[model samples]
Each structure stands twice: as structure tokens, then as C-alpha cells.
Target chain A: MANSNLPRRIIKETQRLLSEPAPGISASPSEENMRYFNVMILGPAQSPYEGGVFKLELFLPEEYPMAAPKVRFLTKIYHPNIDKLGRICLDILKDKWSPALQIRTVLLSVLPYCLLSPDYLIFSIQALLSAPNPDDPLSDNVAKHWKANEAEAVETAKEWTRLYASGA
Target chain B: MARKGKEDYYSDAGGDDDYEDYYSKGEDDVCQSDTDDENSGSDDGGGGGVSDGDDQQAMETTDDIEPKDREKEYDFETEDDVRRCQDEVTAKTSELLSVPPGFAAAFLRHCRWDAERLENEWFSDERRVRGAVGLAAAGRDGDVPTALNDRPLICAICFGGYAPGEMRSAGCAHYYCHECWRGYIHAAVGDGSRCLLLRCPDPRCTAPLVRELVDEAAADEDRARYATFVVRSYVEEGTSKYVRWCPGPGCTLAVRSRPGSRLYEVPCACKHVFCFRCGEEAHRPASCDTAGAWVVKNRSDGETSEWVLTNTKHCPECRRAIEKNQGCNHMTCSAPCGHQFCWLCLGSWKEHSGGNYHCNRYAADKSEFTGEKTRREQAKASPERYLHFYERWATHGQSMTKARQDLDALEGGGLDALADTFGVPPTELEFVTEAYAQIIEARRVLRWTYAYVYYQDPERHGRLEFYVFLQAMAEGAMEQLHKCAEGEKDALKVDVGDYGAVFPAGYAAGKLAEFRERLSHLSRVTRSHFTKLVEGFESGMAEIVL
Candidate 1:
């Protein structure tokens, strides 16, 4: 949590995210840890998570910029790709990450889930949530239900979003 | 060639078997390469006909020396050979690309380290080559801008304005502040990206970061990691498909087979042997695909779970595996759960009275497969069949392990007693050491042969009778050898010095000599049997014409 030696690039990015916050999202570094940020992302319109807000925690490790920041959802929402532990199955955070990417870019890139087409951006997070891919699902039960009965799966996802994320 | 040193023991056995045939075949292959080297030299010196003729004569004489005589002369190399091999590629690529060695290495890697392919592609389209490697053509007058040390620039990633001294660019000449570049390069390495080419930060500019710029800006740790990435990229992707790192854990050795060579087992420098066609442990007699499938089928829990599903029922309460051994309606789980239930219906035992036995009626719809009876019969017979062979294989395998341990012990101290009784040098017992090693090798081959037959379904090969005969012959020879060395621990334990006193009647010399001769004879027959079996597989059983 310590930020005694926080790099200038991280500091500058933190100030910019707060000053020019992206639409549908807000993030701020903690007072104790400049590397740690508390984030809130409003669910995209028409998605299962519509009318709800999801809380997430993001941390820049000691090797930030050289390493992707760790991000995990604190609020639980039902989706096939996202696991129960809040891990988003996003490629940009893994093998596809390039140094040209920034925290703002990543957030914008992930925000369109449920609204965008599957191949949009060649990796659409929205398409992933709107239409779960059972082949590479993070939650096996959710994937199975989505495959066996779609209407029931969508109903459970809506219920979860309303219960756990609506007040956030 | 570590193999050369060990091969002498087999040669001394004086058996004109296929074991020696295979050894000489490998040597002959190397001999062909040696002559090719001489031919290239003579062609280069063709202009000076007389001196060239003299040179050719000398080369031919040197080549004529028996490969056996020079076997111990060549030095054995390991991982360092891999590094040297990379250096050769880097040097060749540097010349062709007109770039520094480091830049050349990076560029060659993007081309998958095939220098010939890179050359062909570069000559066909220079512009595409430059663009593909992320280089901008010589920035005006063939000079790459050294460092942006003279002016200031705005970093594209963080939007930080920095002094020109802190800016760098790739071939496209789009510069970014040094801080951003460092972070980007480090992050790329941390994420373990296999992309050897790092592109410019400007979303539109596809120019890759050149090696020189990275060397100047990246930290020592990042630079080292980048170097490793460069080498691995070349070794794994850039080289021929046949080149493979030894699969032995913690072994840094690699081997590259001769082009067009048939797939065979390779014993790596680390002493871990594996099949080249598939990187599994050397499994002979069975083809790579068959062995791989068999290993997976045997290891998966499907068989065990399926057997339990068909043969037993879970306890109604505890859910533990329970077999209905007594064929009774009432059953009590032996576990602490001690739940009682009717085996037929899995219902409460107390409810099973007069007519409750109706649940015992045969369920005709239980199996969907039409050949259920035959399948059940096969299922019952397979393990019994597999066990029949696997047990013998496993026993010999254990014997091999024990023989190796015994050989190691004999070499360590038992040699002194052996030498004292024989009145010969300790080295005289080297043959015994080799005999034990041959036993181990033969046992391993025999073991896999059983596995091969288990899955091969000899009936389909139209030579079931021939397969049975050959299997019997090979197994019979191996079993005799196994019995002599292992089945009776005291039978072949030759502490000749102890035997001298025990056999004061003067039969100790005859006994020890006979023991050595028998060991050699068994090893030879076992070797010949294995060679025939392997030849049968290589020929796809065509030798069994019937």
C-alpha cells in the first residue's frame, strides 16, 4: 500500500483520472496508498447489469507500467466470463497487453460489454457478457445454465446484478 | 560422443548381431558428413590444381582412419553449443541486414531465425522487410538518429514533456519520452509477451523499438530479460522444426536431428531418453500416437469410476463405494456411517418385505450399446490380459532398477574383491559393469514390447500366430536373464574372493569364468531378440509374411 517511491508516470496518471474522469466511471487513489485506487463503474445500458453500479479495486504493483495493474470487482454480478471471485477474463490485462495501453484505455475498452458485437475491437468485453462463451467460461455452472437454458440464465444474472450491485 | 565410450563393451562381446549393425549405421552417417566436408574444401581449391590434389590426398588419408579410433577424440558439448549456434545465426544475420549484431538478432527472431527465409523475403521487397521489422529506412543519408539528447519532446504515453536527451525512437522515428519507453519495455517482459519486436507508443506508428535504443534506456535487469527472450525466440521458433530441447527436468541440453532422418529415440546429453517424434519418454514397440493414447486412457479416472458404477453401488447415506458381495436385499455399510439399505432398490432396509424384492428385476434399458455383452466380456478380459503382460514387464523393470543399484555397488567396492580373486586389474571387471547396464537396457525394451502388444490388437495385423511366437521368444530369453541376475539374489552374486575359500576344492575359477560367459551369452541373445522385435515394428510386420 506504501507509495513513498511511486513513479512520476503513475502519479501523473492518477491526477488525470480524477480530473478528467471517463464517463460511466469514477476512480480515486487511496490516501494511504497512491498505488491503490477505489473504482466504481456504472453498468452499460441494455446489459444484464443495467441500472447498477459495480465497485472494483485496482492496484499498481511496484513494476507498474512495465506490468499490468491488478483489477478485481468488489461487487458480485453474474456473467459467464467473470468468476465468483471477481476476476474478469480480459485479454488486455494478460497476453494482449502492450505498453501503449493505459488504465483509462483499459477501462474504456472493458466498458462496452453487452452492447458491442463479439468481434468489435477484435475483442469486445460487452459481447462477451451479453452472449456468454461457454467454451471458455470462468464460471462452469453459469456457462452450463446459459448453454442449457438461456432465458433462465439471463434471469439469474439480472437477479444477481439487482441484489449485489444496484445500491453500489 | 559419450555413446562411443560405452559402445566398446558391446564390441568386445564379439557378437555379429544387429546391435553392432545399428552402432555402425550411426557412425556411417557421420562418416558421410566428413566426406562432404572434404569435397567442399577441394572444390574451393580447384584453381591450384597440384597443391589442391596434395591437399585432397591428405584429407582422404585423415578421413580413412577408422571412426572407432577417433571416437574418444571429439569433445562433448551441451548448452554452450546452443549459445554458440545462436551466435552463428546472429553473425550471419548481421551481415545480411547490414545492422549491428544485437539489432540483427532481434530482427532475425521476428523472422523466426531462418536466415535463408529472411534473405529471400528481404530481397523480394525491401520496403516490406523494413516495415515488417519496424525499421524506418536510413533516416536521411543512411544515419539512424543516435539519441534525441539535443532537444526536448513530449511523451505520447504519459504526456510528460522531457528533455531531448531522454527521448528515443524505433525505425519509424516517432520518439517517446525515456520514462514511458522503460515502463513499456519492462511491462512487456513482465507479462511474458513473446513479441520480439516492440512497437512505437504512438497508436498510429507501427515502428518497432530498435535494439540500440532499448539497450540505452532499459534497466540492467530488463536488458538481461530481453536478451533471454531474444535467444529463446530464436531457439524455439526461428530454428528448424526438428530441433528440440531435452525434455528432462532441469536439463539445459538440446538436440537437433539431421534433416530428413526418420523419427527415432534420442538419448540426450543429460541421460534422459525420449522419442523425437513425440516428446514422451522413449516408448518403443508401440508407436508414439498409440503409446500416448494408451497412457491417457489408462491414467484417466473414467475406467475406475465406470467399473464402480457398473459393479458396485454407493452407500445410501455415506455415499461410499459399496459392493453387494452377498447378493442380499439387506446391506450394511462397513464404514462408521453404518447405514442399512436394500441393495436392489437402495431403499430403507426396514421397508423391504415380501413383495419389495420386485426391484431386483433386470433393467433391459440400462445399456444403450447393442454389443453390451461382448463389451462387458472385453472389459472383464482386458485388465486380466493387460495385467498378465504388465506384471512381467513391471517385474523386469524392478529387476532393472535393482540391477543398476547392484552394478553401482559392485563398481564402488565389490571390484576389489573381484580383482583380488581373479589376480587381474580392477578394470578387467568393466565388462561386468557393462553386462549389468545391458541387462537394464534389455529389460526396458522387453517391458515396452508388452505394452506395445497390449494395445496393438495383433488379430488385426493378420499375424496373430507370428506375434505370439515372437512375443514368447523375446519374453523367454528376457525371463531367463532376469532369473539369473534377479530371481535368485544369491545365484549370481560373484564375490570371487569368498568363493575361493568356500570352494577350496578348486572350482571357484571355473564357476566365476562360467558366470561371466553366461552373463555375456544372455545379454547377446536378449540384444538380438530386441533388435528383431524393433525391426518387425519398423517394417510394419511385413517380415511375418503369413
Candidate 2:
């Protein structure tokens, strides 16, 4: 790991995030591993996944800042881009990652309701859930069902979110 | 007489076409050759049995096979060669800019080393060009003030306070502590990032860092690794149009190809020759795509499955393949399925029992030939066809391998000993190794030629009858060359540890001279024949009307 500054940067970002938590979004570092964060985001209202709380896990590996952080959904969700294993095919999490990006900016852009730009990865995922693009999909079976019947697929997605992602 | 017969045969077979123009132009040479042969009153033995039509075919193929392009040359021997090559480009750019070579090198690398494109962009928008290459304005202020209340300033990355003089700033004036800069550059290099063009540590500023600053900031080990990345960048990213890393494993040499030349086989300084086009082992007489496809197909287990499908029948119940050697039309699955069915029609065994076995002599159905059965028969024949070509292909491949090893042993002191035994200089025996290499190359070509011919669809590609004829000629020449080389190995005695048996002193130097002459002759003949064969294949093997 280069730059004895990664841990310092993460601490500063964590402090700012706690002091000014974005509405409906929270991220706290685990006690055992300071680099690992447990995160949760409330689903946007008026969408099929409304009123559900989605949990995610984010970790900064040894080569943090040089490489992007590894982030995945711990709560199951039905979306064309996110597969059954919760692996999100988001661009910023992969090849399009810039060292300029950090955790606060990532969550702010990815949440369906708090989308800052139309071209961001989270905005694309939200749009994908509302209207799935089956041609370049990650889950073949879900894409097939979505293509064969749109209303039924939406109902199934809502049912999955209510059963698995509902938080007390 | 042969020329007249050839003309008559061509007109009769080809009707009226553009090919007639080719024949008419050759009339003069044919007449002159006929007169010369008559005057000499001599006949060639090889030409005695061949017909006039065959003579015309050979002449046409030989005409088509001659190479039309000039051969290219490239040589890259050392790491210094790469540095010098890059330096030449940098020097040119520096002269035009009137700036330091280091600055020019960074600017050129940013533009992928295309100096003209950089010049175009530089003249079009000077400010944007300067910003892109990270040439900051001379009087621009640093991100941090030169001094803050006469106290030490804190570094943004490590959040550590340092005296103003303790920190360093690049051309962009983005100041960072020395330790932090070293760690940043070191990690960047460790990740295989193109660190030569690493930018300022301040994320908001996209100012590119210069090598001089990086050298001052990095430790000795990281600096050395940074220099390596710069050199490799010249081949991988900087000057990729003409230079490439040698495809041989563990070979550090780079091959520089002559610009604008057709891709050809390149022999590296390491003695590993490969196709510059596909970067594979040299595969002549077969195009790069065809040779690559053949190698990939040869590695798969599809051939075994095809063999199983052709040789056995699947049980109707459990789908297990069963083979019957000597049985009536009645057959039973040998597996736990134990399903009984007719071998001929695959009908249930109950229908063919109790005198219903009369179906054994049943007549053929037209529907069977028109449908899946025909496909099954073709699949059965497919493996046999492949084996026929593969066996010959593999034999030549084996011979080529042995010839390569023999050539290596000969080069390793065998040539010197043979020269001493024969009372001659070593240069006189050089042709022996040269001949063996030529034979090996020709055998490799012959081996892949079979695969090339097998993969060609005759109906679609206009049945390469002429190509096959040239291939046979080349194959015959190769076999003769192979036999001569193998026979020479048996007769020549050498004291190499395990290479050859030593001969008695009674053997004369005259016999050795004769053997050398034969080897040289066969090597030249084999090369010419294969050259003609490659030409025919490349020309799409134009059909001979007869």
C-alpha cells in the first residue's frame, strides 16, 4: 500500500459523512476493520422498491485510492444490472473508476432518489429497474422473464423487495 | 511440337477467355525454346514422360508463384537500442519546440509519440496544449501559499505539517511532502500503471508530473523500476507502429519491422523465428488465419467425440452408446438400461421377435438417405478423412523437429570436428547446417499444406486441382530432401557424444564432398517447389481448363 495517507483520508471522509449524513443514507466503519464500512440506503419512494432498506458492504483493499473500493449489495434486490450474487455491474466500480471519486460521492450518485447526474452508474441502475434493458443484461433468466412479460416481472421484483429487503 | 499441342489443348478446353492473351504472349518464348532444344539435340529425363498439358500447367503455376515484393529487414539487440530509438524521436521534437528533450519526450508520449499530430494540436491551441502536457504558466501561484503566517504548512495527503523547504513541488507547483510523493509514485509503479505519465497528487489538478521531479521524489529501487516502465512503454504504447516485443517466452529482445512492408517471418536475435503477422511459429504455405485455426482445432477433444458418435449407437432409453460386433438385427443395451431395439431401424425388440425378425432383409428407404442417416454417415467418414491428412501432417512435423535438433548438435562443435576430419576449413562445411535448416522449414510448410488443403471446400473454392498438383510436386521434393539428409546422417560418422557413430579412417573426403553437393542441390530444389506451391495457394489456385 502506497501513501501512508489512505487511512487518514478514509478517517476524514468517515468523520464528515457522520457529521453530515445524506438523508436516507448511512455508512459506518466496522470496529474490527476500519477500512470496511457497513452501509444502508432507503429505496426511492413511488418506485416498485419503495419503503425498503437496502444494505451494502464496501471495503478498501490494500491498493485503495490507486484502485477503486470493492462495493456489493448484501441485501438481495431484483435489477437487471445486479446479479443473484449481488455483484453490481456498475461502471464506476470497475473500469471507469477514477482516483478522484470517494465513498460519499459514490453513494450520493447511486441512490435512485438522490441522483446528481443522469449519466451516473446509480442513476442507470435505477432506470434499469423501472425499464430493464434485457439485451445487455447480467441475469439471463430474469431478462427473459422481463422480456416475456413486463407487468409480471415488476410484481415479482416488488414481492422480492418486500420479503427480503424490508427492515424493521 | 509440344507448344503446338499445348495451344490446341488450351483453345479446345478454355474456349475464348482472357487466358488466351497469356498463352499468345508466351508463343515467342515457346518457339525459341523449341528451336534451342532442336539445335542441342538433347532431351531431359524429367520432361520425358510428362505430357504437353502438364508442362503448360507447371509453367503457369511457376509464373504465378514468383514473389513480387521486396523483403524487409529489422534488428533490435539491446535495451539501449530502445532508449536510443526513443531518444531520436525526442530529439526531433525538442528541436522543433526549442525546449528540453525531457519536456518534449513527455509531450510526445502524451500524444502517443506522434510528433506531427502534437504539432498540429500545439499550433491550433497553444494554451490547451500546454495544459494537456502539464506545462504550467511561469508565474502561476502554488496551490498553497508560499508561506502561511510564517508557520509550517500541512501537506494535504498525509495531513502532516512540514517546513516550507522540506516539501517539494513539481512544475505544477502542487506541493507534497517527499515521503508521501515517494509512496504515491511507488504504489503507482507497483500497480503496473503507466507511471511515466503520473499526474499531480492533488486530485483536482490534472497536471502531469515530469521525470526529473519523479526521480528526485522516488527511492533508488522505485526509480530504476520507473525507468524500466518508460523503456517498455516505447514498445507497448509509445512507438507501437513499428516495434513489438518478441513473442518468444522470456525473450527480452524487441523486433522492429520495416514500415509499410508486408508481414513476414522474423528471426529474433534469440534464434526463435516466428510469423510477424500472427506472432506464431513460422507457418508458410498456410496463411496465418488458417494455421492459427488449425492449431486451435487440433487441441480440442471434439475429434474423440466424433469418433465415438460414428462407431457406436446410443440406447433409446438411457442414451448409452452400444457397439455390436457379431449379432442379428436384434440388439440390447449393455448398460443398466437393458433396452432392446432393432439395430437396423432401431424399432422396439418386441415387434421384431417371434418370427418378426424378417425385417433383417428389409429394403432401403429413400427417406433415410435424404435425412439424418446421410448426415450420420458423413460424420462417420469425417474422422477418417481428418486422420488421412493428420497422419501425413504429423509425420512431417516429427521430421522437422528431429532436423531442428540435429542442426543444433551440428552447430555445437560437430561442424568443426567434421572440418578437421576432412582436412578443410570450417566455412567449407557451413552449407551442411544451412541445408538442414532449409529442409526443416520446407517440411513444416509441407505438414501445414495438408491441413490447408483438407480445410478447403472444393465446391465453393473451385476444386484446387492445380494447387494439389503443385503440392504433390513440393511433397516429392521434400521427401527426396528428407531422405538425402537422413541418409547422410547414417553415413557420416562423428565423435559427438551421442549424435553419430564414428567412422573408420578408410572413408575418403571425396565421398563427403559428393554428399555436400547432393544436400545443397536438394535444399535449393525443395525451396523453389514450396515457393511455387505457396504462390499457387495465394493466387486462389486458378483452375487449369484441361
Candidate 3:
């Protein structure tokens, strides 16, 4: 019922996301709202958050494709770029967003590598966990901690990932 | 002889109001004759026999000397003028760069409209310039596949399959559906003026979505908005060094200061005058820095510090500020630091027993109280000094508004009524208009003098006194003119209930003529005094001793 009256583009993206789910990521549309998706991203390997599963929520606004999708973390994690309330500081989610970018491209994409799409370099939630940009941080305190003492900050992040992001 | 010659020339022209033609005849003749006849003409004083030629001579002489009187020269340009300027630059850049006007405009914007720099960069390295400007360096030759393909291709955006010709791109192979392109442009335009630099929706593509693409794909409203942003960018960022939009509310005019001119005061066509440097109301006689500081000082809670010094006493133990609303001499500091002290001497209240209060006596600790006493006295004196000038500054500003309102009332309907009462044409009441104009100008100069005096160096021993004297002279002349124009004119007004019943035609005409003469003379005097004040301030009061 929620899928009724959804745009052809959104329906197509949702179908592709379900049939060929990206590696280490799962997303499913909420039953009450076709635009809302419950998302889960596995922390990238070799990162401090390696064995954790981070939950996120994504919603395509009415002005989707024209506007960027709203994505926020639901699980608590100690990352410089993600604030306590789970806002992100990614450029693609804000000013640098292009209409060409799909929900899969933002969450996790398995598009075949091609020369035409040279800018597509695995812009995924796991990639964000792997490379937490501390410079343009959403959390000032976390960024300060990350800048002042990175190794200690990484240990705190690892502890938080184990305590909060570990899916029991 | 030259005055006679000029008068004959004006008379021969047959239009007494041909001041523009008279002025343009010869600057030397006007200046020379102005000096010779201005004093005698102005000094003739309210004589019933004063001719129209003499009045014209007096006014024209004032105009002739005005260029030397003020420093800055500027021209007000309307929004259409700005667009014309933009088009001219776009055309010039297009011809020079050997590109279309749209591309030229984009290139000019990329280089901040510095055509010389764009030309230099384009000549030296075209590819780098193209890349920097977001143009496809691969050239627009065959990159755009506008020809219909055999098979329909899927658009990268919207995930919708479209016919080959239905997809569009900005001279790049990264094609998206027209609907998506329109949405992207709409969103960018809605964001604000940054849409002027909108690039292709493909992230990796360096192709700029030029005006052609916007015109072809953007919605009607977005296209208009994009055009506005383009023109605004040309004025705001392109020629920002010399041109500035007038800060007047809802005014689309701009003022372009002459290049290398250091003048700040700019009067827009909307009659809203402002400082070009600071964008504040035109404040002459005060430097932009001083005017800015004075405005902040006026707005901030500066009096709070002074009030604290006078009304509240700090707790002796914890230094917490405590105010005594209503109580006896004994004061107790609030909780957490409940220090008790005498209000008068700030001595420990423990020493003063009940019904034996003698805290009124000065404490025996002169060294302890000296600094506090001096600081308190200084704080008390500071606001008084500030208020002295502030009250006058604010009074003149209010007077200016009231004078403007009076002028408006006179022009709106009062002039015709007065003309009917005096049995003269409404055009004959121009002296009243001139008087109000003089009052407004004098009030503006007088108001800014207070601001200048507020920041005047106190160590400049006699300079402040001299400047105040000049300000008083200007203000004194202005008040006389204001009274003659406002109060005296009101006295001449025949009551509407008893219109023409009390005063005879001859008596009313005589009164009107006398009032006009006095108002004109006062206007001239006030103008001269303010002119001197401006010159004195402009020269840093060099004639007076420090």
C-alpha cells in the first residue's frame, strides 16, 4: 500500500537495491512509507569499527533526485564526522550532491566500474566508517579529540563501537 | 560688464529658467560673474523692488560654487543601466575571446569579470582556463551526441529510459533527461545567486551549464531568477571595486563612484544618502571608522557600566555586584557569599550597632577609597558628557525628519493653500521649498558634527571649543531659517474657517513677500555657515590652535 503512487525512479531504485544488495549492506523500505528505508552498514575491515554493524535510516524527500536524500545513523558510534544526534558532514549529502547520484550510490553501490563514471569511487556508508573525515566534523568535541590525540580517540571510538554498535 | 552681458544673454534666451543652458555657456563667465555679483545680489535684503534676475543670480551663484564646495563626484545608475553595462562587457569579451556571448559571460564570471586577466589567461593557456572555468576542455566539436541513436538509453539520473533525442547535456557525453536537468537547475536557482556558476549534473564532468542550457531547460520562474542572479553577480562581484548597489530599501539603483575617488558620501536617486565606504547614512565631518564606532557605542549597553559604578557596590569578600533596592545603611550580600557591609562606607556592618549608625561619615581609609571614588566620579561624568553631545545629535536627527515631513506637507497641499491665501501662483512659493531644503542640509551637517565632536581628541586643547563654536553658528543660522519657514509661515496662514475675511489682499501679499525675503536670506546664511563647517572639518581644523 505504501508503494502506491511512488515515482517510477524511486520504484526502480528500490527494486535494484533489493534484488542485488551491495556487499555488507542491507536496506529495506518501511511498510508504512515507501520513501523511508531502514538501512544497516557493516563497519569496513581493518577499521576500528571492524566487527560492528551500524544501523542508519534513509529517507527520500518529495524533491528526490533534485534534492539529496536524508540519511542519519540510528546506532550510537564515536566518529568525528557523525554527531551525537547522528547528522553527517559529508559533501555529497549537502552542497556537492548531484541529481545523478542514487540512493544506492549514497548508501552502498555495486555499479560496474566504468571509465565514464570515473568520479564514482564507492561512496558508501562503510567507506565513511573506513575514512572518518575529522577536518569537516559534525561533532566539535569529537573532532577536537581526534585532532588532539588520534590514537586515544581511535581507542575510544573502538570502545564505543563495541558497546553500542555491536549487534548482539 | 560681464554680469550685464550674462544677464542680456539670459534675457535674450527668453527663458528665465534656462539655468542649465546659462551654466553650460561658459564656466569662466559664470564663475567670474558669480564672484562679482553674488554678495551685492544676496545683500539687497527683502526690498519690495528686488527683481527675479537678482534672485536667480543668487541661486545660480550657489550652484556654481558647489562643485568646489564638496569633494566627491558620483553618478546614480538604474538597474537597466547595470544590465546594459553587463551586456557591453559580455559583448566585448565575446569578440575578444572568439567565443559566443554566453561562454564569454561565463568566462568573465569565472575570472570575476576581470576581462584583462581573462584575456591574458586565455591567450597564454586556453585549456587550463577552460578547465578552471568549468568548460569542457575537450572542445564542443563532437562531444555532444545530439543525433538520435538506434537504441534508447537509460538516463543515469531518475533511472528512466528515454529516447535518444530526449536526453540533454552541456556539451558533454554525460546525458540526463530534460526533466532531471530542469529540476537540477530549478534547485540550484532556488538556492540563490550561486546558480550563476551551475555546472553539469554529472559529478566528474567539467562542463558548465551555460545560459543556453538554462534557457532551454529551466522552468520559466527559474529562468527569470537565473537572469536576475546573473545581473546581480555582474554588479556585486564583477564590478564590485568601483560600483555598489544603493542600500536604500526596495531601491534597484546603484552608485558608481569615480575610479580612485576617496569620497564616501553618496546620494542615491531615491534621496537615500549613505556612506559608500561604510554603507551608513551619509555622515560627513566624521571618518567612517569614527562613525562606525559611535554607532556601536550608541547601540551597546554602554550606560550599564556607568550605572554599575554609581548604583551597585561589590561585595567586599567575594566581589559580587550587589544593588540595594530599598534598605537602611546596613547591606547584606546575597546567599552563598552572604557578606554584610555598610552601604555608605562599605565597612563591615558588624561594627555599626543598631540605632547607632554613623556610617554616613567618610571612612578613615583614604588610600582604599581613592581609586574607587575617582572611578565612580569618572563614570558619572562620562555619561553626562556623552549625553550632552548625544542629546544634540539625536535632536538634530529628529529635527531633520520633522523638517522633511514639513517639506513634504508644503509640497503636497500646503503650497496651493498658501498661494490661494496670498493671491499668488503656487510656483511663487519656491522660497519655502528652498528654506526646508537648507534646513535639512544644515541639520544633517550639524548632526554629524556632534558625532565628530564625541570622538574629537580631548588632548587637542582648544580645537573642540572652536569646532563647537562653528557647530553653534551653523545651528543658530539653521534654527532662524527653520523658524521663518515653519512658525512665521504658519502665522501668515489665514484660518480655513475665516478664509480671506480678516486680511485684505494687499496686506496678505505684503506679508508673503516679507516672509519670502527673510526665509531666503536665512537659507543663504545657514548654507554658508554649514559650508564653512564642512571645510573646517575637512581641513582637520587647521585654522584653529590645538
RMSD of each: 15.8, 17.7, 17.0
Candidate 2 regions exceeding 4 Å error are A1-6, A10-20, A96-100, A111-156, B1-72, B98-103, B127-176, B193-204, B238-241, B299-395, B460-462, B494-507, B540-546
Writing each residue's lDDT as its tens digit, candidate 1 over B249-300 gives: 8866555544223335555544455665567766665565445544433443
Evaluation by lDDT, superior candidate among 1 and 2: 2
Say which prediction, candidate 1 or candidate 3, comes out ahead on lDDT: 3
lDDT (Cα, 0-100) at A44 in candidate 1: 71
**What ranking emerges by lDDT with the best candidate at the front?**
3, 2, 1
CAPRI class of candidate 3? incorrect
DockQ of candidate 3 against the true complex: 0.18
lDDT of 1: 0.58
Chain A only: TM-score per candidate: 0.86, 0.82, 0.89
lDDT of 3 at B253: 69
lDDT of 2 by residue, B283-395 (tens): 75566545654564455476654444345565665444476543233455641234777665566767644323434333542222122343343345477777787788889
Candidate 1: pairs in clash? A66-B187, A113-A126, A114-A126, B112-B238, B136-B171, B148-B164, B149-B165, B151-B164
